[model samples]
Target: MKFFTCSVIMSVFLQVCSQNPLRYWTLLPNILVVEVNGSLGQQPLSCLGSPQEGTRKDDKSQGIIWRKNGVVEEQRGNSYLVQLEESLGGGNYTCHREDGSLVNHTVVLIQEDQTERRKILVKTDQEDYLTCLAQNYNGEFHCSWTWNRNRVGKVALIQVGRISNDSDAQCSVDVSTQRWTCSSGQSNFSCSVDEHGHRISCRDEQHCPYAEEIQQIYVTLYVRTEQFLVENYSKQFYLAEIVKPDMVRISEVNTSMIEWSYPSSWSSPYSYFPLTFQISQFRRGCKGCDNPCTESKPAKTLMVHFTDVCQFKVKHKAKAVCVRAKDALCNSQWSEWSHLRLRRNNKNKHRQNDKQG
Candidate 1:
């Protein structure tokens, strides 16, 4: 019975040790040498148990107690040591356990030193529109105009002649209209910087030329007003009387047929005037010559004769003119003298044989 009781007690003790593994614990830096005399002890003890298990009633608690330099620096675990020296002044320090459930030791924490603020510079091309931007490591900065009144805001500046603005950062000047306003013939323009302020100046109306040529070519005349006044505004004036083609004349070669054409400015689809030619031999400078040709009406082209009685003789000259009339008044221009030279009999016979062959 006695042996069975000792065996049962040993079995229960082994089971408890195996189940509550927190009984074995380790602490870092087992020895702390201090410069002052103090008393130390551990309190508010806790456990570092396995993650798979919750707090068990059989879990063992371990701690430490020591003294140094009249101050208490309590630590926990086995093989602990504390030494006292004279260098460290009197102060209160506390060191907590890894789990923060207990105070293990104490040391004073001093404040760290600081560094100076950083500075940066920005630059760009002077010819371009003024634009400013800044960025830093912390991604926060401020931008403002340091020179010109036109660019007084955070944005860029644009100034052309008298027009100035901050929203649109580019300046443009219309030099063509500037010349017309100054009544100048020739104009030169240039773009420059106003560095006294930060404005971009576009200069115009400098070194202008004469006035007569500028006034004559620069006038804007509308063709629509002339058409409106001729058609809609005036009822008494008709277009047929004002828009007639001048220099009308006529000519004839023989009695059988007549050929005619005109040199009027009346273009296609606007006017189509035909001619009628009458031929007569009134006066002559020599043989086979017809002179002093007159027309009863204005004809369009020259007259051609196809009759046998009016066969063209050798070395004969015929004159004709194209004529067009309006309101019984005719305008005429004469054509070049049409020399009526007949072909030889042998040439005509050869042409007939070539056609037949």
Candidate 2:
């Protein structure tokens, strides 16, 4: 009789898979993520029990109790069938023994509707849902995302590690600090979510500025909506690629001399992570003087400064002076131009005109 029951269960499982085809992943320890196509109708979720219970998910128990999103529900056997409609059909399903001891839990997520359905989060202007940046190479970075107008959600999980060696990475969270930590052989990272749930900040404690980085960091954030719909957004980058130096402070020592320093957030020893500076001085009546001009503007400048001590000398006073910096050692992005508008005094103006005459 038991053999006959196993055969019937196998037949039904294969039949379900054949229709919609299922893909699942173990998001955390016993937390499973099941992806299904909403248009495909119903899908079956098997109770993958704990390691000690049995190896196969189809193993028999002393009867099972089912619950949907923490509330008990009537579900027979070891499998619970869920419809494949959008949020209406999605939920967190768990099965326990008749004694109420837990077995396993699965969170069902519907894929972007192939025909007419939409995803939980919309793409941003940059064409991606996630964006990350680093102020320096101190093994720290922050990633942010835009929430969909109607389907706001929270981060369900975060995974970060070096490329090709992240399979064993483990992540845990601290309730008190609301911070998360992911540790692996190569590095240890701590991350925290912002109050608005739109941004996450992370830091690597063991990062070395001098060490050669042959590997890249890969990060994935799993976000879920109130309806139990989850989506994962991932990004891979090297520290140098996303390194954006802070604005340089340009101070006027004298009319002819302008002095500036490295951004305080930059990595130290200035020589090791040197920066290249560009100084531009705009003349009066220039049409583009209203905004910060890029290097393409009609400006005369040279990449001269490569240390913490940055200074530029002006032969004549002009409308404004702008300064920007970029990583001298790497082909990275330049910082925003720091502009200082110059106002010529009438006395100095008369003196200059007399000298010119």
Cα TM-score per model = 0.16, 0.77
Question: After superposition on all CA atoms, how large is the RMSD of candidate 1?
Answer: 41.6
lDDT per residue as tens, model 2, 1-357: 999999999988667655552565667664556666543446666675443343354346437777888899876556667766533566778888877888777776554433444466677888987888899988899999988888898888888888864465798877643578899887788899999989999987888888987888888988888887778888998999989899998787776778888999999989888998887766643455456555335346667756756777864746567888899888988999887765444558789999999
Q: Please, what is the whole-model Cα lDDT of each candidate in the order they appear? A: 0.27, 0.75
Error of 2 at 127 (Å): 2.9
Runs of candidate 1 with Cα error greater than 4 angstroms are: 1-236, 248-258, 270-357
Q: What is candidate 1's CA lDDT for residue 152?
A: 30
lDDT per residue as tens, model 1, 97-150: 335444433322111111211111122343312232211111111111232232
Candidate 1 clash figure, as a count: 29
Q: If candidate 2 were superposed on the true structure by all CA atoms, what would the RMSD be?
A: 6.1
Residue 16, model 2: lDDT of 66
Off by over 4 Å in 2: 1-21, 39-72, 76-79, 86-88, 94-107, 111-118, 285-290, 293-299, 343-357
**Clash pairs detected, candidate 2:** none
